[model samples]
Target chain A: MSELTGLTLKAALEGLAAKRFSSEEITTAHLAAIDASSALNAYVVGTPEKALEMARASDARRASGQAGPLDGAPLGIKDLFCTEGVESTAGSMILRGFKPAYESTVTSQLWRDGAVMLGKLNMDEFAMGSSNETSAWGPVVNPWRQQGRNADLTPGGSSGGSAAAVAAELCLAATATDTGGSIRQPAAFTGTVGIKPTYGRCSRWGIVAFASSLDQAGPMARSVEDTAILLRSMAGHDPKDSTSIDAEVPDFASFCGRSVKGLRVGIPREYRVDGMPAEIDALWEQGIAWLKDAGCEIVDVTLPHTKYALPAYYIIAPAEASSNLARYDGMRYGLRVEGDNLTDTYEKSRAQGFGAEVKRRILIGTYVLSAGYYDAYYLKALKVRRRIADNFDQAWQTCDALLTPTAPSAAFALGDKSDDPLAMYLNDIFTVTVNLAGLPGMSVPAGLDAQGLPLGLQLIGRNLDEGTLFSLGSALEKAADFRARPAKWW
Target chain B: MAIDAATVRKVAKLARIAEPESRIEPLANELNGIISWIEQLNEVDTDGVEPMTTSVAMGLPMRDDVVTDGGDPAKVLGNAPRAEKSFFVVPKVVE
Candidate 1:
């Protein structure tokens, strides 16, 4: 595990290509590592047999001189992505014993690119909660410790397992979906890199819908280059996913070493929220200084609608979720109940299968979308969402990208905010606005909290401008010098 | 801001979930707390802002409104609790 940590994705692939180590060996090591790190609870289901089979095929392809860029690399699939012949639960019991006959375009594309499948990782049930604690499977523990703090803390969510896996070197990279900060939040918590590309940049054909309007899948990895390597393989249009963009993807790797000199970075004045921890503030200041050192100009900008984003997101996300989830009517790919009547079966199946938090969200979603309440709740939230996007539009005029803290603070204790939904929702405030605006965003570890847990700074780019975001993120990662290894590993 | 037990029960029914009356009070309290917090949005004035339905602004594609999909009814009903050949098996409705 120690040897696996800090190895760049490109280097690892090259090592495999050169036969310095076989893909089978790497896959075996990762499988053993996952077994050893069972206490972390990073995985929901591990498919070592399938991983070895994939690795053997990859090695065979390489021997035949036909290998892809991500050849032989082991990657974890987030439970949210549907894999043909594998159970895709989205972390809910409702989908227990359910198996999809089709693979998500993204998952299959990765397979075509020669990456080995590690297993399905854990997540928040139906991608609803900010902390993985809401998962029917259980919470994922952060591998990093908070100084003398002996108790385990959350790895963040709903893509916590993906982040934790990459951070602990359980896998080189993992697929993660972001509706409102699922990818970036978990990355920040685990001190790794996570990117949420522009909306529609990646296909969502077979990914389970949480909030269809906002959900987008992206890469999580140990370094910016690893993210670029994986993103190139994952991005592009698919006719199966009508929402996926058909635009040509720029060579993202080429931008990694390109100078950030003369780039304009915007600092949103409204992001300096009340009660923000001093450590987070100081880390943000340091990030701004790094941009300044890179010969970039900084200007103050205002997103006046910043405070309204959380409420708007809460309403819109749930409203969409309710509509999308209606497909799972106990007669489809999920739960089914035994009852004397049709309506009773539907009622009983849903009641017995869904967890408390998931049902609460469905209720909230339904309430906001009810016949009499649509205008006041759902429509009004949509209005605010636009204003928030407009705020970004105004700021982009003065800057190429916007800079802020990824979260208010670093990862908190697992049960710290478990009792308070509002407090948990606040953790996503800084990251959600970018999603609402349809822009690209990335999280880079900046420094450590007072208790030594890692803090991260986020960078937001213009829509479809992932190349710029990764370039800036890579440069910042190199300059920040805030490397903190996980406190424990399998 | 305090939602009563009856309101919680009513909302659950509207949402199509069945819950016992005993659990309604706690659900109501939690719902009240969350809704009251969301009420903080009332302080902001968005008088003229247009609602944003999707982050990417584009018109949804419309089809010809003709019937197009129907196949493998048996496969579709395979996961149902009870199905007979190609149709979902619901209790008989008429006497």
Candidate 2:
């Protein structure tokens, strides 16, 4: 691995500003690293020429004293974002060969700050699955494997490629979207840092829609500071997306290293779900202790609606997804299958285009939103969602933030739970409520599990209070002091 | 409610996705499993609770009725599977 590829995003920025090496050199080094790490399947497309061109421009800008915050830094984009002139498949055959004519607002912002694109990363088909197995491109193998084991484990999805790429040092950081733990769960699995900012914190204009209400783009990196740095560039109000929050973007990096003293951190007792691993419990205790040591007031709180979040999330997400995906008929872009008639063409194209999981979600979505079942399923789930958010609202009155295990367990083998959709859905048990409540949540690598894979603790903050999460996250990052990297096997 | 094969076919048609007879049973079973799991929501009392349509509780921001962008037909049709001149070509509907 090249030394340049190993540097954190902040370190790379400093190096570029110091002129220790040109952006071209670092970008080239990362491109080579990406080439050597193809077995990981982290990136779906590798844009070496485009990366070098952007890097060269960044270097020239630096020489002219016009460098941006992320000038010359290379990052991976989750294929969910529509990159102009680059095929954005959302890891499904339905969108095969479809490239957007315009760039997503988030990626365009990164480019404006002089960030170089390494190419699109893979994800679950339309961000629908808990594991990357749903991806038509293939599953992303986690860089970390169990000690003395030969079997490859899954980097959690649907941002598995982004997490794997950052964990493997293929990019300084990667852009990811979290609709029901796609970002935070994958980050926890790979020992990287990922944040799902409050809903509407980032624009969803050019990203492929899954569950529009739950989907929010965020950053994934090796450290919380780097994640914060990347997020500052990625977030802002955009008129294009009406849901985009009309708020001032904060200097998130500055929130790091701030004192956590006297802040109240809530521990929700309802998260003590059945069958939680012993190591996860111990890690949560350790995290609470660390916060206590940092002078935080640890309060035990209750979110009674926690148990209903997963089921409600499943109904609401897929219901919205079914409606959002109605645009992918035979006439427009993407894979089209012709038939005897227009309606036949529509049916045939969709049946042939979407993968099994995508088809399943669409089916479940359709069923829930069907004529007779609408009130029983979709409407009931929405009411449950409201209660879940109300639970968070009540908890906020007592605590400044909340902490929990990011996932129930550490990374498992690729095929471990893919056969059971319910089993896969349970993986988001600890992380989904944050999305339901539209709060900012982050995963910080806290410790390793019994099998030596990394475990993360989640920190969730109030709406538009990412700065507080960053502060607490940095403090936890310091206390955990997790510097372990996966042994190179790929 | 358990989703029957007939209902599965009906919903698949509603969703505009073709489902052959061979796959209908398995699809019904899978959908039934998921639907049953989510049916647990009925256990909660929500008589007076309003269904939350969005995470953020705000009205849709309205703008003046005017064209702000989008005039290039070529760009709009750039990714169309089948296009002629400036329009997407679909299977014959009005013929």
Report the number of the highest-lDDT candidate: 2
Candidate 1, CAPRI quality class derived from DockQ: medium
Screening candidate 1 with a backbone cut-off below 3 angstroms (N, C-alpha, C), the clashing residue pairs are: A382-B51, A382-B52, A383-B51
A235-352, model 1: which lDDT tens digit per residue? 9977666667778987787778689999999999999999999888888999999889988899899999898888888888887887787777676557776666766666677777
lDDT of 2 by residue, A213-286 (tens): 89999999999999999999999999899899999999999999999999999999999989999999999999
lDDT of 2: 0.94
The positional error of residue A462 in candidate 1, measured at the CA in angstroms, is 0.4
Q: Write the per-residue lDDT of candidate 2 for residues B17-87, one digit (tens) a residue.
A: 99889999988888888888887898899989998888776778988999878989998998899999989
Question: Ten-residue segment with the worst summed lDDT in candidate 1 chain A?
Answer: A1-10
TM-score top scorer: 2
What clash pairs does model 2 have?
A: none
Q: What's the TM for model 1? A: 0.95
C-alpha RMSD by candidate, in order: 2.2, 0.9
